[model samples]
Target: MSSKPSRCVVLFTLLAVAGCTSSPGKDFFTETIDSLHAKTSPLRAGYSGPAAVTSASNAAQRFNGAQYQGTGQFVSSGAPVTKVTGDGSGKFELNLVNAPIADAAKAVLGDALHLNYIVDPRVQGTVTLQTSQPVSQDALVDILQSALAVNAAGITSRGGTYQIVPLSEIMASTPPVSVPSTSPSGPGVKVQVLQLQFIAADEMKTILEPITRQGSVLRVDSTRNIITVAGSDSDLNAIREAVSVFDVDWMRGMSVALHPLKTSKPEAVAAELDSIFGTKEGPGAKLIQFIPNDRLNSVLVITSRPAYLARAATWINKLDRLAETNESQLFVYQIQNRPAKELASVLSSVLGTTVKTEGQSGGSNVSPDQTPIAMQSDGVTPAPLTGPSPSLPQQDNEAPAHATVVADVENNALLIQTTARDYQRIEQILTKVDVLPTQVMLEAVIAEVTLNDDLKYGLRWFFENGGTKVSVTDVAKAAAAATLPGFNWSYATDNIQVTLSALSKITDVNVISAPTIMALNNQKAILQVGDQVPILTQQSQDTGNGSAPIINSVQMKDTGVILTVTPRINNAGRVMLDIQQEVSNVTKTDSSDIDSPTIQQRKIQTRVLVNDGESLALGGLIQQNNSVDRSQVPILGDIPIFGNAFKQKNDTIRRTELIIFIRPHVVRDINEAREVTDEFRGKISLQTPIQKRRGGTKLQQDLKRLAY
Candidate 1:
């Protein structure tokens, strides 16, 4: 009994120590109770005014924080919360925190402007907004509407009252949408009519339906191909911009269009397209067709889908370019400034084909054996063969691979049966060759100068001056210098008239001819300023028995100054002239047999290169030592010293030199050619009046002399 009592006492002592160690602290237990109360307690209602507080006895019955509640209530601290505030100037301020959207809008519109409003029961959402400054009434309404829109609600003014409704019921509650004569204002619903050009109205409506608002309406008028949308201004504008992108030619579907060709033929292009996008049959095959309108030079495209049309249009644009290559086409190219036959020959040579004239015998590539023969009139006679028999293999040659070029003389066009690539090359060559040739105006002056003591050597010596470098070259020397042959002497000068004028001052200088003529490049021009002399070629012998011997023959020959010049202009504007000039005259009639006239002729034929507007002088045709006799009396002229007083005897020597000056001017354009023509006209007009005045004076002198 004693041992058991001792063990019980020890166990009791240990249990008391363990209890003391596990006990909770006073501060921690208090914090735990406060936290549990704060978490589980109901929310306290905010005090607004005296009405929010119950009667004093009722508040005393309700549990207070620490003691009995008093009658006065505490107002919240810091800035006072105002759902909406206005400055009476159409500007308002709002401080809403999770407030109902309807109450928020009513506070802004009704409390500020005293406006009536109706809020739908379905329009339920809280808006949180806190403005730092005042905003316009329209801006405040816009903010409210945007907040409403985010919650699938919208607001519209109807009958002078704001109606806040769900987006699904906005159109039903508001007035019917109409096309506004002007732009709609203030975030209200609007109506717009969009006319589609390429896409159908119903098709565009399908595209816009997904992005359209729930309250908006998209109506299509198929007959007019127009879509009418009733929505907000923003939505209408977005639809308009989208329609512009989708309603284009490239976006067309199941349509027909015409594309005109500029450089390529429509038939050939259509054929090429047929080879590319060929016919297809079955489901999902592209429905496309190309038809060529040859008369209008246009192609018609028919397609069933926009994608196929866009693909075909891209190819059409590529193939219809200027000078696009193609297969064979029969094209009639109008010959502008060249002969069709000559141009055809040039084209044939360049393209390696045979030329065919309009009415030539073998104009076609068809062989004689291939040509169909006509039946004979009689039944018994067999049809005649158009060519040799088949036994002759040499005559039965194959037709040429390249078609011949046919020349249409009547129209002055070439009928080319060739590919577009070859025709493009041919066109380039034709543009170069078939143009107006350059024209050159050649002016020549032929003068005969009676040499005096001052000009003893020649005109060359007279023309040479200190300021000018005159190169006097004889025929042999000119040939050695690569100058023109057949000219006796050549010299270059700036002005040939200056030398002639100076020579005329000392001696007689007679201008035989001054001729000016215009000739095309590589064409000949002739100028004759003298008479045609009849020459007796044969003399009639007195026949022993004849009545009057018939005069045999007389031939007419051109005499005096005659010039023939052929000018060739190079690309560098230099002229190569092949000139043949002749100065011939009947010196005297011979008293010998046939009484033929003796002719003195001086001719020069040569080729020379001269720059445009430069002058070339050709000379050295001289007659020297010509003696003239004068006698006062026949017997006294031969007598010695005393006879000199009785009769004067004089022998004069005459010397004459012929000089020709040539100058060529190249006329580049019509303006320059007109200027040259006007200058020549002025010169002729001046000379005509001068000649007339001289003739009148001479006539008056002759009349006065006759009267005397």
Candidate 2:
């Protein structure tokens, strides 16, 4: 490539790092707790409130120990800990052989993570673990504990510090049972309970097909198991009254087998799903692991019948195509692989609902009369399902024609990955999605994409496809009526979903689009009061503040964040000629305050809203959150004021956000701003400078600005 093109490429590369292209900044805890290295900023500010404290209760609630503990130790100091024991009550206890080491660990675990030593369920006496200081092990304290403290993967402990609730107590609490394992029995619509187990929140879905065998079908009273339609009773038989039904053939069975619940209770959650939805005329549903954070609380869905999974897959294929953009800049990002136990976390984030999972493999079934946790196989169990779990089907050379939603419920995840060739289908579905009654004039598109840290090019297209007309009623109706092959009409009306765009466009960032739909799962509070509720996207900002992007480097001349030096390549050496300077600029922000005559002029612009609700003052700069709003603002950057003696000017974008890029040294006092522009991935080049102060031989006595 020519030097000119190369320079453009270089500048563009640098801009990607320093632009307004990232998801909304992360919450304080997520960054602080998940950061790998220990940081010491005593005055670092973040949120602290009842909600934040309560929001953190998830980890403690799941284990349900009297006192949950997380331990940390210095790797350099091998501290020994012992004397672990549990009182009759449920408090954990442990002693650290070294106080300093224990204190260091205490610092790492903090209030949320304190190591609690408890009696192991399987082991008798006590065991002490001296763990290294807690840090991000895949972004979790538990994961960190496992990697450094417990010394195990995929294993959780119910600490030794508290009193143990005997397994015998949990069983004795159940009612007495009489039936012993029978060797042989007479066949009469033979039913057998082989095994049952508790499943996590996500695995709690069942797909049952109504029995089609002409003579094999049985009808029973709705309230009791008394078979009224035995094979012999064709007349006046209670057989036809079967309120609930099932087909062993249509069940695809689960993909990853779930372990039986730790409890011996017989009534597994899986059986209930089938009976409730498997009943005649019942709407079959699946437990989608929408929230993957808390396993204790999860959501259950009355989903489009199992038949709709096929159609949903086809539609997803089309969406995957729309997400495909320039290969030069890919934004597909996967931060962490959550576990099945984290299903509730994913569900919570996606659907904003409470959900949980519970089940086990090869466990006996639970009965209606018995406790919900009862374990007895006397009742005949539904034959386990069989077939291939849902996946992208094989095709020849062309792209796929379907969409598939893959949920790792056990792992608490739902990944929507689709191939190319479904863009037209996606567009068609989007255009027709009038799912709700009152239309929500979308003011923002929150395009979310995962960009490589290299920041060359990540996601570009904001939520341009959003902010268009979408109807909730249509989407729900379609979802309700949707079936396989023609899943088109099914979900377009009801499910009303948007595809994952590598760089999905957010066209409008108006303030009125409140309680906007996210994940097609936001079931409540659709429209916001336009006047009372200001849209985050609609908030205005000035070029002086909002415009200081993460540049390769920049200098302030009483204006916005403009490139102080342009990229140029040396023809002789082919090396990039960059000069990263720390300039001290002192200039008046407003035209009225004409101070510091050394500072020249400030450049600004006013753009009219060509498209309705567009900007006239705040050029291309987003005034609100970047995540929830789409990219509609156009960025027309700045130029330095020459001669360094003129007055600073105003951008005159009326009633919009105003930004002023003060010299770096000027804003070292503002912690937040400093954090915003630290080491913004730009390089500074140096050539030659000579000054002989202490009688030393110097090459030349001047500075040189190289020419391209």
Tell me the tens digit of each residue's lDDT in model 2 across 530-619: 122111222234568867553322233322122221122222312111111121224334554422224322222211111111111111
Tens digit of per-residue lDDT, candidate 1, span 379-424: 3332111123232123112222233356776677777665565555
Model 1 weakest lDDT span, ten residues long: 699-708
Q: RMSD in angstroms, candidate 2?
A: 55.8
Model 2 bad stretches (over 4 Å): 1-397, 402-414, 419-582, 587-708
* Whole-structure CA lDDT of model 1: 0.65
**Runs in model 1 with CA error above 4 Å?**
1-332, 335-417, 461-477, 480-486, 534-556, 587-599, 623-653, 674-708
Candidate 2 residue 23 Cα shift, in angstroms, is 99
Model 2: lDDT to the true structure:
0.25
CA lDDT of every candidate: 0.65, 0.25
